[model samples]
Target: MKNTIAERIQDFLKQFPPFSMLSKEELLKVAGQIRVLYLEKGAYVFEQDEKCHDEFYIVREGAVGLYRNSENSQNLVDICDAGDLFGLRIMIIKKNYRMAALASQESIVYAIPSSVFKPFIDENKEVNTFLLETFATHARNYYTETEKGKRIDNTISIDTAKDLSTLRTISYRKKPLTCTADAIVKDIAMEMNARKADAIIVVDEQKFPIGILTDSDLRAKVATGLFSATAVVTEVMTAPVKTYAKKITVAEAQIALIKNNISHLCITKDGTRNSKTVGVFSNHDLLVSFGNNPSILIKEIKRVKKIQRLRYIRKQVERLLTTYLEQDIPTMHILNLISEINDALVIRTIELSLEEMPSQPTVAFNFLVLGSQGRREQLLMTDQDNAIVFEDVEEAMYDETQTYFLELARIVTKNLHAIGFEYCPAEMMASNPRWCMSLSKWEEQFRTWMTTPSEESTLLSSIFFDFQSVYGDADMSNQLSDVVFDGVNKSKRFLGLLGVSALQKPSPLGFFKQFLVEQNGEHKDTFDIKTRAMMVLIDGARILALYHNLKGINNTLLRYEKLASLEPNNKELFESCAKAFRVLLKFRARQGILHKDSGRFIQLNTLSKNDKLKLKRCFKPIRDIQEVLRIRFQLKTFM
Candidate 1:
């Protein structure tokens, strides 16, 4: 069944994203599944909100204009030239098209079946990134300012029959960490951690694969502060693990992850649960096949010398983030991992900057990461919020010390800007002279803010309070935390003000049992996820942590968990907050990733009913916690 026409199509695809990311063999496999269609000039490909087609289109000849029909006006927001991909929204998010695709001229396009492409996205992240970026670009272009929903869908889970299949087989890891079926889930999870493995297979006495437990499972159960880790392995494991022959085609492994809604598959000697385990196939293994690995990324980051190269690595991290999200890794873990990567990039940038300096630093200095970066909650590219803290010296040396670090901060911020972190619009960055100062000055500034809490002070508290040292003196960070804790303890009014700030955003739900969406301005008629849902959770967590004199826990979800432990009387409420925060973080991340934006806001109309319900379920705690804060802090005056 060799098709010469498909071969030509593959030749064209090899020059594009996702296709260029794939090997020659994999490219042809995708090409074979593509159904070539010719469109006369000005022909329609898909209409707005029509039930999604099973295939996504890529233009081969001519052009396509993705247009939205609103208020009886069809506005062409984006045009697709040859090789541009269109009509992928249906595949992602499993929703209908938000925009209609029309041939701008006579065109020939390759309709790649979603079935064939979905597996690739799960296995090859570059392909996944390509699809997501495409959807995000379209969403940002059209959906951001509009009430239009159904703009995009998730790229994974598309099912199309394979026609041009590659002979590629996914090689599973041999001797995967396994435990007896009766083993305690806590013990099993411990074994997994000890082995540095994210998954563990449960086997029968006969050494047959009976169940598989993955990181995602551990996250859904253990991380929520729900199930006891002491539960039996069977309690959390996906029972009757999908077993395949020791040698499984890449296509088969992918289909299994999708069909079973599972991340790990057991490869057994006889391709059945009755047989012995031979290896384990996981999404991580698939991603590694495409040359994406954290260890490798670290290596690349270290060796990269150019600012542009660091930018490139940061881009790779985006693709990596998409992979982790697709695998349903806990958002907290994803945040931590990506934060480490960001820290590394910043550290490397510092090294490069210092290497370029005329002389080494005369005294000790530390780099401070403020805001979301400071809290390790940052998952998307954001404005740089950082400062420089240098050692105190003699008055003569103070100016010299300031000059040296100022020059250093300028270089670091410049390099970081080049690396894709935009300059702080408010000039909160370290390069600003007011923020770049000796450690003693930072203490003075923090003390002033805490003692004299105001609207501006409260604003600064949200950013500066979460300072974590990315590089330099760890003891300085400890000292900073001590200052913050001492100030909050001494100023009870400050804590009350903080509590009021936490409750600033009212309950997410309105009187009509509908989401209280934004009514006007830039994000009109949309759900302000950050200002409404997530910030309420974050603010509540922050103020509670302040009240408890808790230090070192900055992430909102983790803070709630800490609150739960500290206030066992309200454990149920705190746990609900933690879970709600987790869901909101994931929701924002998906919206952000799909739109290539901050993911802080979302259009209500764009979400599915199930998604809406999931969101609504999280709001009860907002009301409950605000009540607790209101009574505890006597916030009637603030309200």
Candidate 2:
């Protein structure tokens, strides 16, 4: 007869421990021979002098007290929580029980037959390591002077940035209150007053954070009579609010607050501005994260007057970035703050360059940042990809205007290199005469690329299309965006070609469910995360955003998020892509910081079981989105 109780026992065991390492067939066999025992509070499961039992026990519910006895006195050693295992020492050593087990509360435990479990212990490395760590932490710790593992303690903290690798996790105010962007200031202020909260994040219909309103806004903008109290939140709230994903520690949270100069930060589901709000942090949370002095760095950046000063400052920023990564700050948050610092460096370099010039420019021009700078997802110093888009000039004066702008671009790019940004190998910077052009010329170039997409055109446009105006006339950049999107809107054939470009990288996994790694050359057997993983999401987001006509939103995570809101039926899939993009970004940044290089090619053998699982989980979303793109654009027919 089939044993339903044992099948249920196997199900519970599979989610936990060394049992999880066993095959379903093997686990069921072990489960079939196990015995279930129920005990009320203070009931003894085993005594100190009991003979060895063939089975070891796993607590399914409540808690068990493991006590050490000496001279007619019992010392409570440890409280074993749910999923904790005990009575394994006797089975391994073939000795009598050394300690007594009693129910601290009513509990259910499964006694596993050791005869059926020994083979699995010898076979699985992860299982063996886990069991050894468990014993060393639980059994051996109770015998140590400090007795660290005798209780579940999470109050550890490391203060200095130098020692940040061991910092503790900081808690946040979870499930924070939020209002939509459409809400009026007066109503939201009343809600804030009622809740006694200092700030309220303004979200969109999907609860995606768009901006934030605070008591400061009420005082500075409303109380001063600058804006009416009945004005909408969008009219006053600070837009592009700083956001973070759920897993942050004391060190990461502090850096975020000081770096952004914000008293409060919006914690969201994906740590991008496009995700639903989940929690919030303020100056108080910074204190909780063990506040470090960050004013020095900010003062330097703001007061910087030379290229060498910024070069020195860039090193400090790298150190700060290392600490944040080591402390496990969410990648999205790090990207947001670090990118701000990078942009400031560019803007400052541009200012200093203009000061060195003989006079102000003859016409308004914008420094168009491209490549990773354009995406705003850059984590490390990479090649500069930029161009110059100046106001249109009379054809007769074109030669003069081009010469003036080229000279200006030369100084700006040179200063940027001194400030640590590497020069583009392909001369893609504004310093290249080809990249510096009139606004109308840039518009014509974009129209040409979209209407006639080829391999070379696709490669060049992929970097150029994500152009962001770092400094100068912001309005000029807006005009360029409208022109590019307008051209894309006119051609279904172009959209299909862009869709085909997105599918250029196939699945990141191969047969045997292993990462599809570089087969030969310098990075043989190593994973190409940038080309195979990050690019997939980045390309997908760009094409989708263009299709939906979303402009000025360059970050891939925000792109997927905006896509999710626009298509509710595909929201889950889109959100999954966003989450996966974040995980990959974080993973790459961490690897980069660890190995002191571009974290592009990753060695697979270095990863643990858990790390592999996290990386593998991201591939599913990548596969799903590519299929959606293929079917939607009918790209297979073109292929």
Candidate 3:
């Protein structure tokens, strides 16, 4: 009397959407009517233009690729993986199949009879909405204008950045050739010939894009006999597909292609591989849309083989920065975009250095950027702060390993210097043996710094604690973060010491509420905004974040935002800190650009009355946050 197979199928169905909306009793009843089918790679679940089946399918295992036949070839529309629903089109339209569904791998599927599932659509509102949305997304505009539930947007907006057409939405090839991972190279090549297409995307069974095969791959692999035509496309395909969202701008697409040195990009619904592939963007697309502009400057930065050309590109970026400021773009937006550009420069520099090395690296490692650049808040070129953390190795190989990475770092830092970033005066660079070490050694260093609680260690912690992994293995960096939080948990004295350090910077304003100006050096009459104001806020956010054990939040503004969420009573004060930090950072960036130097000092006389007032208003949050740190850490006793 027990239907064991139906119960198993029911259990699997309940884990996914639509079915998840069904009651236990209802799901079991539906499951009893379901039929199970087994399929091998290349087996067809259904073929294009075939009459509708009596049931819809859900992949219980492996992947099912939905391919639309076009121009004598098949183009993959979407992939359905485990728990992913397919064959739903028949349920809605009661029409013939518009695409073929084939198993991309050995698979098991559950066929849920539409006769049983259709009642749920009418009875359960959640199931109806979910299925409709899923159907709409996968339809890829297959529905005509007269279709039910169709709505049009009449809203229009003025174009401010019309000249910057790269900001405009990209138009890509919607019908590029795509095939399953198990598809044959020879057969796909024949299909390409039939369609006169140059590229084919290789997708996984679950419909996520996994790799790409192009004419170049065929010439190098099949023509040269590196691989036989009968071989699966995965053998020669360029893998781990680069995916972008449908909303990706032309400029972003161009840079993404150039930066990764790839020719094609998969445009997905959500800009990640987890979503279905919607279209493909290629170099051919860029050729028409491309113009000589900021994006071109960035593209040149990535393409230039020589380090000297990078310096020229860096100058162009400065001009771009000026133009952005003049355009009055949001400061945070500018910060993020320019920071990405800066990161590109650094990442390219590392790539070039690796190529110049006599031999390849032996073990996994991570390149870390520290201080402002690490926080992704460096809008203006400042001193380079970086380090290296390689995977732990045997004691015997330590010296040689360190020497190799240090040499690599030496070249990278030298290249970065040539590209406008100055070297750290204190030598806090990966080239320094003290900063470049194995992961375990780095962990030990943090543990020692926290347990000892010295002034020097606290200074180093502040600098190094904010590190962001720029290249290589990110897991190494994550492990380092784990060590940092672990060390913080074990040492309360270090926490108090860090708190005292945050409070060490005096109030940005004097007792008379006047701007605190430097009394000595070249900036004698100018306010030391860097130390007097920004540092107070930065240190306060950093210390508070560590006290609450907030990991991975390094940017001062973001730190305040996260802290506000954690303590609602202090939310107002914390949000003010984030707002003030943003204002100060923008002010510093603007001054830096004007002077063509590090924006640390600001002359009080150059500002308008309102500018001066804005600066004073931003400082109140600094005083308040520092006081919060003092009381939270009982810093009065430590002081």
* Root-mean-square deviation (CA) per prediction: 15.4, 24.3, 27.5
Top candidate, metric TM-score: 1
Provide the lDDT at 267 for model 1.
88
Error in Å for residue 94 of model 2: 57
Over the stretch 82-189, how does candidate 2's per-residue lDDT look in tens digits? Answer: 566888764345657778999888888888778777777788876665565344223322121123333312212222222222133446788787998789999998
Which parts of model 2 have CA positions greater than 4 angstroms off?
1-296
Candidate 3, 1-639: lDDT as tens digits: 998887888898887778878999999999999988999999999999999898999999888888888888886555666667888876665668878999878899999899999999998987875675455334432221222423221111112112334446788888568899889988999999998777898876666788899777788789998899899988989878899988887656665665576778898778888877788887655644442234445555677687865764675566566656655666666766677678889889999999999999999999999998888888888999999999898999999999999999999999898777999999999999999999999999988898877889999998999999989999999998998888888877788898888888856788899987888887788888888989888888888888889888888878888999999999999999889988898888788865557888888898999999999999888889878888877888998
374-475: candidate 1 lDDT, tens digit per residue = 889888888999999888888878887898888999999999997889899998988888889988988999999988878988988888888889888778
Order the candidates by TM-score, highest first: 1, 3, 2
lDDT of each: 0.78, 0.78, 0.80
TM-score of each: 0.59, 0.55, 0.56
In order of lDDT, best first, we have: 3, 2, 1
